[model samples]
Target: MTAPEPYAGVTTHTPVRHHILSVLVENKAGVLARIAGLFARRGFNIYSLAVAPAEGHARFSRVTIVVDAESAPLEQIVGQLNKLVNVVDIKDLAPRDALERELLLATLPVDDGNRAAVLEVVANAAASIVDVNATSLSVVLAGTPHACDLLERALEGFSDVELQRTGRVALPRLTQTESL
Candidate 1:
């Protein structure tokens, strides 16, 4: 069997569909733990999660969570989250209505034997080499999940590769207001 591509741009291999949830919560100690515990107790699988301060204010934080939409009904997840004392709001940023991006950092072997070849691959992906040593190169790519997937796949042809991706962070598209 082929290894699972966990970050292949929200897959559909099973009955479960992927959903991106933007959770706004009080930026206080232990709130993250509480939220995580709720998912654990309910057996919800969070594919990717990133939490950081929202609106440059220390009073509130936003959590960008990618979860299996079918593991449980959407209402259940929302209800459970609402019960949390620190949770302020939950927004479902459906794929079509959001702008999503991820960052990938990969280190590949790049000695005289294949330096040119590796550079070619990186150039094709429009990624930049952020670090370089005598034997390896570290490339950084920030783009849509599919672009990152393609770059990762291409780098597989080379040897001694190590990669890490900052799962995903998405924001809902802005809508224009109409004058009354």
Candidate 2:
């Protein structure tokens, strides 16, 4: 048989499942390193990761990690995480129970021929034009992953584009009777 097309299987029929893990760890030097090393050793991929100090206590930090469920079983990942000395707690936040967002910055070459068109694209997506130089325009988009993806696609129409996206950060969605 002839060779299959290069991108034939890029899209799969089944949706990829991901799990959002909220890890609380001691906010001390090397804690992050230890956790990252654990994932490396286990051959698990962290799709997205964000870390920040937890509320009311500088001694603990919260890490939000997104992992492909198919890459490694949930129980295995959590078990390995729990074995770490600095890990204090792990909460698996289901998609329905969490709010997630990512930020993207894009710079595109803009000349008189395409400046207005680029501005229109940014306005249509509710993104902001953060800076404009003689030869380039920079934009910032902070929103849900889908929204960011849409903006990125729109910007691709322009040439000489540079883009950077922060991996997702998520928090639990609070119910009516719940409080943070």
Candidate 3:
């Protein structure tokens, strides 16, 4: 027999950390459940998951999920995730070069006082706030995971965060077609 393929991603000093997967699925209830169930069945740790309707129509929904697992089983997870009924396609944004990721966060108390600071930070990070109220604010940001991590570290202590992140939705930088 031939030698093994080294399991694709298993080795000493291999860093198993955060990864975001962009899933294209039918926009319907329980679709999320099946996706989550796949991870549960495999005993993977899901850091966060967010699903929403893709632009244009409600037929398509993009599910972004962050997971921590060694590379060895990563491909298996993606392959399995694609077999689900509702999941049309599955792609890992974390491993691609020139992939763009965005995250939206809702934090309480977005008034005049800290609003400027918040906006300032947003400007620095090239992010945007789409919703705001006297008591809460929601902002959409596009960047690498590091950018989200920095923003969370800075704002979490100061604001009441009802944190939700769209794991990581990405497309090729040169591509004209954009969708989950």
Candidate 4:
């Protein structure tokens, strides 16, 4: 009989589709690289990483990672990640208890022809323009995640996007100390 795959248990044991990785670390250069390298060296993939400062000496980074790995690898990664010199805390945020997630977006191609529709569409989506340039516009939006998704797709219809990105910030419905 043929052997089963190594990571097949990922589907059987756990069913978490997406994860928010909250990590606390000391503020220093090369720390990000070390953390990133750990993921890459172990065949772990990080979908998105957002690192910023926390109060006091250490820093906090909320990593929006798509968790799609076997239980063993997941545990190993977590264990090793904790061993890093500057790492203070590592936790995986769950989706069910998750309450609100804000997505800030910046879009471009803001010439005379597309500005009207862009504003109208995003306004309906509850997004407001924060910055406007001769050729590009930046918008700040706070609402349901679907609102952000819809706004992005609508902007795509205009033409090839000059630049676009999102800030994925999440908070659970009930505040928790940490997650495993």
Indicate the worst ten consecutive residues by lDDT in candidate 2: 1-10
- Candidate with the larger lDDT of 2 and 3: 2
Candidate order by decreasing TM-score: 1, 2, 4, 3
TM-score of decoy 4: 0.69
Local error of candidate 1 at 94, Å? 0.9
Weakest 10 consecutive residues, lDDT, candidate 4?
1-10
Off by over 4 Å in 3: 1-16, 55-57, 96-98, 104-143, 156-166, 175-180
Model 2, backbone clash pairs (residues 3+ apart or across chains), number: 0
lDDT of 1: 0.82
User: What are the clashing pairs of model 1?
Assistant: none
lDDT string for model 3 (1-180, tens) is 221122343222213565567788998878888887878887776766777787676799977776676633777777788789888887676544437565657555666566667676667667778887667777767667668766655555455667765665555456434455
The collision pairs in model 3 are 109-135
Error of 4 at 153 (Å): 1.5
Model 4 residue 75 distance off true place after TM-score fit, in angstroms? 2.3
* Predicted structure with the largest TM-score when compared to the true one: 1
Please report how far candidate 3 places residue 50 from its true position, in Å. Answer: 2.5
Ten-residue region with minimum lDDT total, candidate 3: 1-10
Candidate 2 error regions (>4 Å) = 1-15, 176-180
Candidate 1 lDDT over residue span 1-180, tens digit each: 222233445433223477788999999999989989999999887888888899898899999888887788878888898899999999987666778888999997777767777887889899999999887889999998778878887777776789998888889878623434
